[model samples]
Target: MDFTRLSSVLTVVGALMLPFAPASAATLTFEDLNSGQASYDVVPSPYKGFAFSGWFYGPDTVYAPASGSIDLFTDYADPTDPGAYVITSNNAITSAVEFVFDGAAFSGYSGVTFELWDAGNLVATSDSLPDSQGAAPYGPTFLASGYSGLVDKVVVSGVQGYFSMDDFTYHAPASNNVPEPGSLALVLFGLGIGGLSARRRR
Candidate 1:
């Protein structure tokens, strides 16, 4: 093959291999509990190629004397089971929750999984299995597609008394399948080729 043709083939092959490169793994942990200012933020667009999204809950504040606890549930509508799992004011909530990927960045994750620790015990878990209350009704819902840029805020509602948010976290996919560089690199390389061809013709 001529130098020009060989160069073209190598460039194409390199472009294709770029997409299969390993992805970076990023984890965001929410461990600060500030009164009225309790939240976690994650920019999945940066590392949208993650393979897993997880959240963990630890013990509660022993000093803060509160009446009610926080319940961990997905963003869904189900008046019947308002508080899925109760995290009392005295104990810790620890659980490895998993989420589903929809093919997009973090925007694709629409489910929330975690254990609700009530009074220091694993009271309930949010998963695909059926709950004692019967079939699982509402699931962890994400904001509308248009609102993907905004961080999806989840708050524990319907508390009998008062409580505080200690920690939260979110994980993202880290694989070549999610954000493949093949498409992006190919486009850029194609643009380069187009420009070169145009200049040669001129």
Candidate 2:
């Protein structure tokens, strides 16, 4: 077998398999919390196999654009405000982050901001949007992260508490342990060629 040809085939096959690999991504729909609960002290809950903390999730979360049922939000009875909140993943989930800001009608909208983090290091931030589109059911602002996966946590702020969010989506990084079927076939073909070349030399 020609070693050079084998190396080349394996490299090519590996590259070709990436797009087919399953990224274990998931979304938090905030549908599990009881509708009557209202607090930021809830224990970490697991959703779609990922555990997350920070922020509050319930029916009080304003209006969800996608689920139209419940959402994750930061707000409470206004005797005192509940400041900025966070949504943290217990695992290193990466890539294709997305969410919706369910803002409501309010006079001085303080805008909404988010910070993506990996291992306590900041990764990316969405430009703070005051949603100047005017209030009275502050038109939901959809946000996506510029950075993908390895982001383990997110700090949500600047909405000043009484705000809503829904459909927190993210993807896990593609695994390197498995080969796609297409790539495996290509590898077998390359091996056959190598075998044939070796046999011809005899």
Candidate 3:
């Protein structure tokens, strides 16, 4: 049996599969929030791959961001005065990371409390971070770190007036326990060839 050849083939297959181990990222730009209808519009539940919660603003309507696009803002329609908006994804976010936004519109004192959750269970939370610290403004980006598991839900609350959310980002792993079809096929092919050669030698 040509063990060396089989080892080399398996190594190549492993290399090809390495890139898939890392999570794939997806971003919700909020550009299509209004469906190109108007500048000011109310966000709906399950818009742009995200499920929203605690949104009572029926027609209060949030205006466009500094970029003049349909973005996410605090809900004033809800009697909850200080509202905490929740956005949850349908899939699991293996790595809950930062987002992009340009905040500080009403005042520089704008702060937010970010909470990360996984399937209704709390995972991690961030201190009240200033709006202008992460991105330019009206942008992100909640910077989260030191989390053991992934999160699919995020809760964000504003300290001052309404803050804008230009975009949000999250990552989803390719597959939890499978090697993917293509990679798996290659590995089986390599083994088959080695097995055939050994059989012929017998």
Candidate 4:
């Protein structure tokens, strides 16, 4: 057997398998929170997976969206004040970060703002709601993609905390120990054994 030709074939096979590698990703819908819960102080809460915190100087609560039965957290009691909610993942999110923000979910008139950040820098900022198209029964959903950076937390702020959000999705930040594609690993293993066999034959 020609070891040189075998090596080239394995190289081609490994390259072809790159796109099939496993991806790291996650999503949060806030649907697990109990309806009508009014504080972040609840221990062992539904948001345990996320380091969730609410930051509103006034009243805040989690309730279902208008015309929909999904739970959302907001401080809509005064649809005229400013408040925010922050959630941090156990690991950083490094790609295709996105979430659903329904500004009108609170009053169908007010808009909200969102900020993505890491431990030190701001990653991205979303526009005020009622998006360019005006408010609808369902608020606007924001999407941030293609950028390459690590974000561990997302802050949602609104004048009066009257906005709603759900379906938080993102690609989890990769770890240093992440493995290569299975096919590539197999190819490498085969190459290592073949190289040893050729050495013995010589």
Q: Tell me the lDDT of model 4 at 128.
A: 52
- Candidate 1 Cα errors over 4 Å, as ranges: 1-147, 158-167, 170-192, 195-202
Q: Which ten residues in a row have the lowest lDDT in candidate 1?
A: 101-110
Q: Tell me the deviation in Å of residue 70 in model 3.
A: 2.5
Candidate 4: segments with Cα more than 4 A from true spot: 1-24, 35-48, 55-68, 80-108, 131-136, 175-202
Query: Which residue pairs collide in model 1, if any?
Result: 49-173, 50-172, 50-173, 50-174, 51-173, 51-174, 57-93, 59-92
lDDT of each: 0.31, 0.53, 0.49, 0.46
- Candidate 3's TM-score reads 0.53
Descending-lDDT candidate ranking: 2, 3, 4, 1
lDDT of 1 by residue, 1-202 (tens): 2467557767876785675564442323222221333432222221223211222222222112121222222122223444633322222222233222111111111222333333344444333222224343222232211211112222222221122222133433334264446776776687678756766776
Tell me the RMSD of model 1 versus the true structure: 15.0
By lDDT, the best candidate is 2
Q: Is candidate 2 or candidate 4 better by lDDT?
A: 2
Q: TM-score for all predictions?
A: 0.23, 0.56, 0.53, 0.49
Tell me the tens digit of each residue's lDDT in model 4 across 1-202: 7767677767876776665554555555444554454443222222534544542211223333433344344433444333433222222222233332222223233455556676556777756555224433334344443345556556655533445545555554444354567855886787678777867888
Candidate 3 lDDT tens digits, 99-140: 221122222224555666765677676555554553333333
- Per-candidate alpha-carbon RMSD to the true structure: 15.0, 8.8, 8.9, 8.9
